[model samples]
Structure formats: structure tokens, C-alpha cells
Target chain A: MKCPKVLLLAAGLTIFASVDSVAGDVKVIANASVKADTISAADLKRVFLEEKSSLDGSHVEPLLEKEGRAHEAFLQEYLGMSEDDLQSYYQTLLFTGRGFMPKVLGSDAEVVAYVARTQGAIGYVSSAASAEGVKTLAIGVPSSNAERKLITRVEPDYPDTLKRLNIGGTVRLRVSISAKGNVEDVELLGGNPILGESAAAAVKKWVYAAGRSRTIAEVSILFDGR
Target chain B: MSTSVTDKLRVGAQLYDRNLGQLGQYHPSLDWAVADYRFKSWFGVRGGKVKTTLGLYNDTQDLDFLRTFALLPQSVYPTDLRDATIAHLGGDVYGSLSLKHRLGGLAYTAYAGHRSDSIYGGVAYLAAQYQVYFSSYGGLQYGGDLRWNTPLKGLLIGISRMNEDVTGKAKAINPLNPGAGFVPYSAISKADWADQFYGEYTAGKLRIDSEYRRFVHDEQDQTADIVLVEIYDDVRGWYVSGSYRVTKRLALGYYYSRYSVTSVAGGLLAPYAPHQTDTSLPANHVYDKVISARVDLRRCWNVKVEGHFMNGYEYSSYPNGFYPQVNPQGFKPNTNALVVKTGFNF
Candidate 1:
């Protein structure tokens, strides 16, 4: 009986440790000049992804930590991209002259100092770091209606030439869903242009559960020659 | 290369392959070396060799990795006029303005500068007009463009206008006049203007693009002591193109393009038999329908195979000059061409 209690305690502690590791604490911080004290995850994603230059009527600039635990966690949790992928995305933006790379700092102290001095600056850091000069932002979770679920999906056709050549890869797409649950638009985030076309055609026919407003979704489809 | 001198100011330089002189031949040149200052999101100033803002693709044309098609539609982005339309040595003011509601934003650019012409221009002039190649060419050029990004995702509409004053000189022995010594002729000295409108939409894996352009040229000739000639040339072109991404590595595209030119006969040769019979030269029109398949072998490399069904003799470089008269019976109104290209860039 005593042995069983010990095993239960050990298992409970193990579960707790795993949960804490996976839910590592991180905080979004902004300069004093920023008007909003809180931001939604969707808007945070937009700002960090360079989709919007302003948030809640205030011009916003995003900063990045060069490479660290905070950087990795921020990318995985908020941006949903890897370090290499984020770098490539910025390169595309730079080459196209659509956007510029955000400023990157070496540590949480550096990030806080820069954000304190710069107007409209926003960044992220580990919860352990002191955000004395900057304002910590409360990130809001998306509402239930904002979570669109796909109800109908159509598979894309593989081109004969590509099949014969045994070429296969994953295509990533960004889809816009209307309030009525119809797919309003789709954009190729990364992929072969020919395969992107076929994937786009099929995605256009996809139907999603109705939402209260427009929702954006990111999806990946794979094509294997065989 | 670029470095920030201050929080708001930066300087950079770009060196790229210059192929406007001869198609498929690359020459190393500085594309832009500039100092840019941004005071706000809605306004900025850039000086040095700035990319021209004439159309949707001009600024990004050199970046192959950013484009969907291996070649932009050739009717508007003609290989022969690439250098003339790409950029200028000067300054530009650019900015963006947000619209009300979820209507998106408006982006605008205004620029001015002098542009150095290329051998391609001279070759095109000689081939089309008088089989006399110009050795040197240069010009002053200016342009502006405006784009509206609508509330609808991935939809943009734009308009652009440009003006240029060009001059060219060449010395060549006239093959038509065998005994004549080398004659020096001003191949081009004219004022040219162009206007264009374009729209693009991208959704899911589908992309569609369309554009229309018109060009007008006023020319004056003083090579002959006995006569001075004045002429006007009008050209129009448009294209509609669409592409689909079938998978991560393959995309298919199709487009239809049309081009036409009309020249008013008012030069020293106006009294010639046909010039007198027709006030305006016969309108030359060309049509091209193309289908292409592109494969992305890697993140930075792509290969494309394209087939073109071409109709009309309007694009025969010497449409009104050498070819029509040299091989009157050999002119083919319809033809086909295959283009295969592999491109890689960083």
C-alpha cells in the first residue's frame, strides 16, 4: 500500500512536470507609447508576420530576440513557424520590397531596453525576465466562433508529368473563410507553382462551419507521385 | 548590402545580372545604390538609382524567386525595352495611406531621373525602322504609379504613367545604297509617353493577372538637309493571365496577349507612293496564346516549359521594313514556338 502511494505521487509529479514544460510561461511586451495594454493572438500573429503595420490605431513595430528559449517559444506558440522558415519569409518580403526585417536583439535585457526607447515597439521575452520599462501585454484567446472547422474537402489532382518524374512535396496555403462558411480566398504561402494551382482549385471547393465573422486558416496538403 | 546608420536611415547597394543588352547574356552592374529614410509608415524618401514605378512588376522584375511565372507577359514587359523601363538614376517619394473600414490601403510612388539606354534599343530600332544600328543611346525618363489594395484579400488594382525623351546616333553603310559611304543617322530623337492599368488577384492556389498599356511616340528627323520629317507612332497592348498551384512543386499557367501598332505617315518619305496613298501605315496586330508548366526543384530554383501559339506578323522585328519586302511570299501569319528556361536565384 505504501509502495502504491509512492508510485502515484511519482506519476503525479511527472505529469505536472511535463505540463509545466509544455506550457512554459512567456509574455508579450510593448513600449509605453503603444495604446493597447492587451492584444489578441490573431492580431499578435498578424503584427509579427508583417501582415499589418498598425494595431488598434497605433503604429506598431515588432522586435525579435536573436536566438534563445524565448525566441523558439515565441515562434512555435505565436508565429507558428520555425527559425529557418521565419528567416526565409523575411527574405521573400525583402526581395519583393513588400516589408523589411524586424530588429533583432540578443537578450531580454536588450529587448526591454530597445523597446523602452523606441516608440510603438513590441516584443516577447521569457516570463522570468523583468519587463520594468516596457508594458506587459495580455494576450486574449480567440473566441469559439473564430475557430472554423472544415466540413467538406476535395482532393487535388496530380499532374501527369510530375507523377512520372516522381516529384512530391507539401504545399502550404492560407485560406480566408467568410462568415457563411464559404472559402472566400486562398493564397499560396509556399509550394510549386503548378502544384499550388491544383491545390488552390481544390481548396476553393472546401466548406467550413459557419463563423460569426471572417476567419483566416493555414493549411498544408501533400502530394506524393506514387 | 545594407547598414543602418541611424534608427531611421539606411544605405544599401544591389548588384545583379543585366541582360537587357542581349537576351540570355548576363552583365554585372549595379542595380541600385541608395540611401533611404523613413519618417513614418505613410511616407519615405529614396535617392540614387531607384527602381521605376511604372507597373506592377518593374520593381520586382529582377527577383526571379518572387515571381510566379518564369517570364512576365512579354507584351508589356518586352525584353527589348527592359532597361528603359526598369529603373532610373535619381530619387523617388513613396508612401502608403490606410483607407476607412476594412478597405485596405493605397500605395503610391513618384520618381524622376535620367536613364541610360542599351544596345537592345538600338537593335530594335534598326530592325524595325531602317536596318541601321545605333552604337550609342541615352534618355531622360520619369514615371509614377498608384496601387489600391482592396479589402478583399489578395486583390490589388493599379495605374501607372511614364514619359521619356530619348536620343540615339549610329554610323553605318546603307546596304540598300551600295555605293553610298557610311552615313551618320539619328536613329531616334523622340518624346514618348505610356499609360497602363493592371489588376491582380490571388486566392488559395489560384492567381490571376491582367494589364493594358498604351504608348505614343513623337519623332522628328533632321538627317536629310533637304527635308525635315515629323511622325507619330501609337502602340497598344494587353494581356490576361492565370495560374494554378496543383501541388507543392508544380504549377500551370496560361495567358493571352494582343499587341498592335499604328504609325502616321508624316516623315520626309511622305511623298512616296504608298505613304501618299495611305495617311496612316497599315495597322499591324499580333496575338499570342501560351500555356506553361513550371516545376520548383528547390527553394531557389525553378524550371519552366512553355508553348506559344502566335498569330500575325506584327512581331517580325522588321514587320514594316525588311521582312515584308524581302520575303513577301514567305510571311507566315501563324506560327509556334517552345521556350524552356531554368532559373535560380537567392
Candidate 2:
């Protein structure tokens, strides 16, 4: 008749997103004290979910933006859970003694400032936000046995009208590569359907190193107003 | 429910419904508490009242906000047993070890403690069937659990073992033979033990889990007449469940649970037959099939509706909510129940 008390560790690393875009496409930001320039999407989700406290030998903590397009974008592009689901999930972790609540800051500026001041803080911000004091960390494939194999990078185009009206967020596209290292196909997974079309068009020009077999990669692009 | 005392130390406690018996009103008491310190992931210590790590969902069972079902599989985690089953007074050594490479990680907890059962719980209700009333029941307990977060994503397996030495004191009055007066006795179990095995798998929005457990108890009642009554209870239970998130706000779940107890009485324990063993008695088993749905009502709240189809709870030596004494009208072989529950967490 006892409630089941369990001593359990969080499950293994989660495998997620791939980094293929560059420059103004930056979206994830980490404190300068963090050692890793690029973090696997799996580890990003782990840290944000409070599954693991350190990444690449550096102790790190995750911060959340209270709400907005950036917050929704981060949840969709990385954690893959709704705001309520995330909160309920956190409550599970808390009651189980598996995790503690990470600080939540309102707006991208608050997150940026907090991350800049906190030595091991990591958070997501708008692509339009200035990456002045914090370091932008690229999300990569942790399951791959090799480093980045891309030979050509194509930047997604942001429609002027959408950018001017501040209607900007993250767009995800599934990119297929042939065994011969040529781009084969691109399909929109999410984001504004129109922005998805432009993101897909740009991703189609991407080139990867030849592999033993055709490789499928998920690519995320940011169309920022700035 | 929890607060940080320092960067490395945290403490918390819970007090809730605590209805010890059917006739007992809701009594609030400190259910569980702990002062825990995590020096490292692989090494930590906790003191005060610690929840035992048994099977799959024991510790988290009290927190309804985190589950899709209105009630867990009662064949194993019975809601009536919550009084003393939730925690023990003592300390624990625990940690999560990250294994090298693809082997994944292992988490473990080992502890020794004192268990104190409530006088107003199942013990009292079960005794009422035999005309005995207990003032207290408790003793020493120890257990541990080891789990492997397998290399395969979303797969986890674990085993747990618990042992206890319990003693209870009570007074019995013969209902028919009023002249017998009140007789005091003590029930002692030197070694009672339980073992459990469980596994859980998660893929996308769907989750599946299963567990099996066995408990053995041999107790002896000693009265001032020097008469000894031997009581043996062999309990077994198992359950398998699956739940899928059908939408952002809704989830569906179903589970089947089987529970049974074969009891033996000897040396006057059974008034009609001194040394009788009834292994296949109808009162000894309960099987259940359940279906449930949950809606995420808000950021910090959820509501669950569940249906239970239960068979064979004619009566029990443990009196787990089904007692012949309580149902003078007799019991139906099969019964169904609908439950709706909403909980908040913030």
C-alpha cells in the first residue's frame, strides 16, 4: 500500500535537429563561459528539460522566455511540447526529485541579459536579437559519427512584407540528400506556410559530402524581422 | 511542495486526504518529507522520511497532476494502502550513474528504516471482521531498487526488493460468547518480504508499462492463554498498461490488473477450522480491466475520467475496500465503477 518511490535517472540522450544554415539564421544562444560552440539538439532538449546539468564538460542551466513568438518558436523547434505540457512535465520532474524549476525570464532581452550574466546559462532568443555578449550555439546532430559534412550553405530568404510587419519565427524543413552529395528534395514540416516555401527553396540548394547511402536531415531556419 | 534550503540541499513534505478507513474522516498528517543533498549525480544522501522506490510508480502515485489515469492499477498500488506504504522514517543512499558509451545509465537507491502503520487503517478494518481492534502496528523495514535506462531510447527496466519485520498488538472480543470478555494478543511476523520487476517503454506520444510483484507473510498470534495462531498470506499481483496522447489536450489509457491472495490458518486462527487452508477462495482474488481519458484543463491542471470493470472481491484477509462485514447484503461477483478526478499543480 505504499506509493511507489523510485530512484531513476533520466533516459538516454534525445536525438534531434541539424544545423545547416548560417549568420543571420542564428537562433540558440549560450553564455560565453560554455565550452561547446555547437550543441546537439538532443542535449539542448535535455538541458531545457532538466534531465542533465552539464554539456560538453561544462555545467549549464536552462532559462525560459515567459511568452511570445520566440517562446513558442523555441518550444516547437526544440522541445516539441506545448507550454502547458512542458509545465506539467516539469511538475512531474519536480515531485519525483528528478529536477528543479529553472528560472523563467520575460522576453528575449531578459533571457539574453540573464544568460550573459549567468556563467553557464543557456536559452533561446530571437534571430533578430543582438548576439553581443552571449555566444550563439549551433544545433547539430549528435547521432552522427562525424562532424559537419556540408560543402555549401544556403540562407533562407525572409519575405520583406513579413519582416517589415515583424511576422517572423522559425521554419522547419526536411531535406533529402542523394548518395552522390546532391540535394534531392525538401518538404515543409512547420512554420508559416509561405515562409516554409521560401525556406524549402533555399534548403534545396544545400550540398553535403557523399555518404555510403542517401542521408535524410531535418533543417530549421529562422526568418527574423531585423 | 518543495523548496531549496541551499544550493545543494532541498526539503519538502506532503499532507493530504489521509482517510484511513471507510468510517474514518479525513485526517491530516505529515505523509512524507525529506532533506536531500546532491553532492554529485553519482552520490547523494537523504534523511528524514523517505519514499520507498518500489516497482514503477510508487513515489509519484500521490501526485495526480502528473498522470493520465484517475487511479493507478489497484491490483498493485492500492489506494487504501497509502497510509504507511508511501514512506519510511530513515535515510537513503542514492544516485544516478552515467554509464560509458551505449550501455546507458543506472540509478539506484538503498535504505533502511522504521515503518509505522496507522491504527485507523486497513489493519483495523480487517480486524473488525474477526472482532479484533488494534491500537498500533509497526516495525522495521529495509529495501532497495535498481533501474537501467537502457541504451534504447524510452526503454527502462528495474527490480526492487523489500523486507520487513512487523508486530501488532490488539484486543479481541467474542461477539457470540460475550462471557469470554476482551482478550489481548500480539501478532508478530519476523520476516515478511516482497519482490517486484517492472519495465516501461515510451515511443512518441504512446507509453507502455508492465510490472509483477509477489509478497509473502507468515504471522503468529500469541495470547495470554499461550495459544498460538499461525496466519499465512501469499499475495501476487501484476498489471500492464498503455496510454497515448491523442491530442495536445487529450490522452487515452487502458490497463488490465490481476491480484490474488492465498491464505492459510492454523492453531485456532480460523474459528470454524483450526488448520484450514483456502487457496482458491472467491474472497482471495480481484481482477480488473480499466479504460481512461485525461484532458489538460489548463497550464497547471488536468482532469481524468476512468472506468473500471472489476471481478471477484467477495471479501479479503487484507480488507482492501471489499469486506463482507461492510456489505451485509452480500457482494456481486462482478462490479463496475466510474471515476472522475481533477487536480492542480503549480
Candidate 3:
């Protein structure tokens, strides 16, 4: 091939690789117990952000990834806010001393480490990542019956510090609850380190007694300093 | 300092029914009221307002064997040491001056406040201090606060230090009198003291705080130096914070600290007393780490809950007596706390 043609082919191949990466689905994971049952998409949102403090009466903690492509996808798909909007919301919270974002880890390995070490921790990873310590939470389609069930029983608020500080704004998270009512694991779908703890602490104490196995839920925090 | 004539003042009162008398004495619920006045830069006063409280104040946290009496969750309380307990039934005075003229870009404020508590005591507190705040980013941001009391921010990192310091008489039995030695001891009339006198400056996301404090008698003295470096990153709605402390949970939130003290003659007290005492002249080196995480959640009803954890060394001494006494070895107990309070201001 001519040198010019060769250069164009190389450029085309690079573009293809980039497209392949973009099209890949970001995998959200949970503890082994989460896969044992199915949860509604709305419930998944509640679990991660701790809108619902408990499933049943047990408390659980949710986890999430630091800002990245996966985080943005999780937020867009699971949460309704964009990355810039979420950042702005968190900034307001920090100044008011309402609460801090959740702890951020660099990789899925780190997320796994956090979930394994903390009692009620949750996290997400690329489906291709290792599942050494965490389990997978089955996310039911929103329109499905399970999703409907999860929605009706939605927790109205997170039992975390952000709630204490009256922090508002939506964060998407994945949660794992144990039979004993403890948040077994967590994964951040979207949010910062400061506001993350409030969600995580509340989730760890959540209880979901009537679920078909363990469940995952998503939620949002709306701050009104009144 | 010059005094300005201002009769009308902002006033508020708090009344509590002490159903469970924490003092172990059958006492009724107490009532306290505070009224403060502000001058419009007439005379030497150039600030917005001066605040002062006058009423019966309870210093139960400083009572004899206070650690044993404190109803705090075990997580927040440290080793049980007996410190002097003084409840001021007199006055709590505060005054601040604004310096918007001196520095055009920053608004400087200087304040001095005093609280005198006396409970079955000869003398309680004559605490006094001077502090300034620079509103560098206009009035939207604040950067400095210096005071003789605990740091007063609503967050854990600010208020965790000296959370409980009841200024009064010592509770140790007199080592000289064997028979008079088993009861809570009282301080010599002139031995009352104050601590945590520090200056702090913060601009944007950084804060520098330092203090050199002393507890003294007419002839003897005990002193300490504390310094802290905190770099706060503000991310709009949420914050990520880390700090290094020179003291235990007493200084700030999740403070990893090391402390040293020098004393010619000073005693350790309980609850708020330093855990370590240096009697041989004036020097000791102590070091430790503090890990703190704080979150302020504003939900329905304006509720604020703060949690703090400190794993490090504290210097506590009950230099006065042995009765209402505390053990120094058990003085610096590991401290953890979760405080939930509902508050509002207009």
C-alpha cells in the first residue's frame, strides 16, 4: 500500500477501537447475595444513593465508583442527572457543610477491596472485571412486575448523614443487603466522596425482610435546608 | 477598650427540665437566659454586635468524677479522670470588633469572651481571649477564628476539641493529708485556669491552626503547644477532608495527633484533663494518628448529625486532688462520638 493509504488505514483502525470501547456495556455488580434475587431499576437507584434507608427494616450500605465513563453511564442510565449537574450539586453541599461525597476508589479492584472490608458495602465494575469478593445484583427492567413491586415498597429517605444535613440532589448507587439487615456491599453509579458516606452509612442499616432473596435499590437525596 | 451606651439588646432564653439530674443531686430543671448588645461603631467598638449571656450555666461535664457521670455513648467518652466542675451562675460575656476599614480586601473581626462558672467553689473561670476573622472572599467566605473555647464550627472537625471542659476546682484528695485524700479535691483559690488559646487562618480551601496554652498557679505552670494543618477541598455539594492533629479527639475531627507538655507544677483532671503529665521541668513528646469522617445531612426539620473518631495520645492531668479524681494512664482513652442535633438560625 502507498504511505498515504497506510496512514489512513491506521487512523481508521484507531477509530474502530475507540468505537468498540464506547459501545461496551458498563457492568454494575453487587455481592453474591444480590444475584440470588431480582430488584427493580428504581430500587437499584434507591439502594445506591440510600433514598430508602432499609429494605424491610434492615439497614444496608451502598458503594460507587469515582468519576469516569462507567460512572457517567451508570448515572445517565440509572440516575437522571449529567456529570456537570451532579458536580455542581455536590459543591453546594460542601459549602453548606451539609455532608461530604462518598469515598472514591481508583479501580474495580479497589472497589472490591472496600466492599469486602466494610460490613455493608456495595460497588459496580465492568462485567469483564473479577468477581472474586463481590456478588451481582439482578437489576429488573423498570416496567417489569418485580420492578413495580420494588417501586411501591420504595424507601422514602436514606438514613445517612446527608439526610441529617438535609443534603439534596440525586446519586445512583448499587446496594447489597443481607438477611440480617446489614448493608453487605455498595457501588457508586454516580456521585462524589463527600455525599457518598451519608448514603453508605444509611444503606448498611437497611432491612428488606419480604424480598425474594436479597435486593438492590436506587434512590435520590433532595436537599431543602428547612 | 471603650464602652458604648446601648441599652436595647438581642435577648433569648433556654429552659430545661432536669428530670434525670446528671449531677446525682435531686435538682429541678434549670433555666438560663442571655442578652447581648451591639454598638454601631461608636467609641472603640467597630463591629456589628457584641453578645453576652447572663444566667445559671451548668458545667456538669466538669463535676467531680465527671467522666463517670457523663451520659454520652461509650463511643464518644474517653478515660475517666476527675476534673474540676464549675457552673457559672454569673456571666458569659462576648465582644467582637469589625475592621472593614483597615484591610480593604478583607473584613477583620476581633472578639473576646469570658464565662465564669462557680459551683460550691471559691473561684471558677476568668477565661478571656482575642480572635479575628478575615472575610476574604467578601462576606460569602470566612477565614479566621481564634478563641479560648473549643472550635465552634457546626462540623465535627471544628467542635470536637475540648468538647467538655468544666472549669472549676480540682477533685483530687490532698496528697499531704492522708485522711482528707479520698474525696474530690478543690483547687487553691487562685489556681483556676483556661486552655486552647489558638489562632487560625483559612483562605479558600486551606486552614492553618496553632495554639500555645498554659495552666498556671501564682508560682507554678504547665504549658503545651499544638499545631494543625488542614487542606479542605470544596467540591460544591460534597467535601473530601483529611487532617493531622497534635492531640487526640480533643483537638479536631479524625485528627492524627502527637502532643507534648511541660509543667513546673500542674495537675491532670478528668474528662477534659490532659492524659499525660510532665512534672520534671517541662517537656514530653507524644505522637499518634487521627482518622475522621464527617457528614452533615439536612433533611426535614433541620437536623445535623456529626460523627468523629480519634486514635491517638492525649495528655490529661488531675494536678489538684485524688477524690473526684481521674487516672492518667486511663486518661487518654480512645474516643469516638456521633452527635445528632436539630438547630436553626434566621
User: For all candidates listed, what's the TM-score of chain B alone?
Assistant: 0.85, 0.92, 0.39
* lDDT for A7 (candidate 3): 10
Better of 1 and 3 by TM-score: 1
* Candidate 3 structure quality by residue, lDDT tens digits, A148-226: 1221122233334544565433333455544343446765544434544554554455454444444444432222222
TM-score of each: 0.65, 0.76, 0.29
List clashing residue pairs in candidate 2. Answer: A2-B85, A3-B58, A4-B58, A4-B59, A5-B52, A5-B53, A5-B59
The per-candidate count of clashes, in order, stands at 23, 7, 122
> In candidate 2, what are the lDDT values of residues B1-346, reduced to their tens digit?
7786765577887665554337346756566688888766567788887778888888788888766789888877877665545678898888776575547678899888988776667766677677778877778889999999898978999999889998888887744454899888677887999899999998878889999988888788777755556777788889999999899789999999888887777775466533324535556677889999999877577889999998878354555567666678988878899998888777
Candidate 2 residue-wise lDDT at A170: 58
After superposition, which runs of candidate 1 have C-alpha atoms over 4 Å from their true positions?
A: A1-226, B18-25, B121-131, B174-180, B187-190, B224-229, B270-283, B315-331
* Local accuracy of candidate 1 as per-residue lDDT tens digits, B26-116: 6466667778776655678788877788777777766655545766776677655667677788888887765754576788888888877
lDDT tens digits, residue span A19-135, model 1: 101113366789998987556665687678765556667778899999988899888877767674577677755653445788999999999999999998999886556677888
- What DockQ number belongs to candidate 1? 0.11
- Candidate 1 steric clashes: 23
lDDT of each: 0.67, 0.73, 0.32
- Top-DockQ structure, candidate number: 2
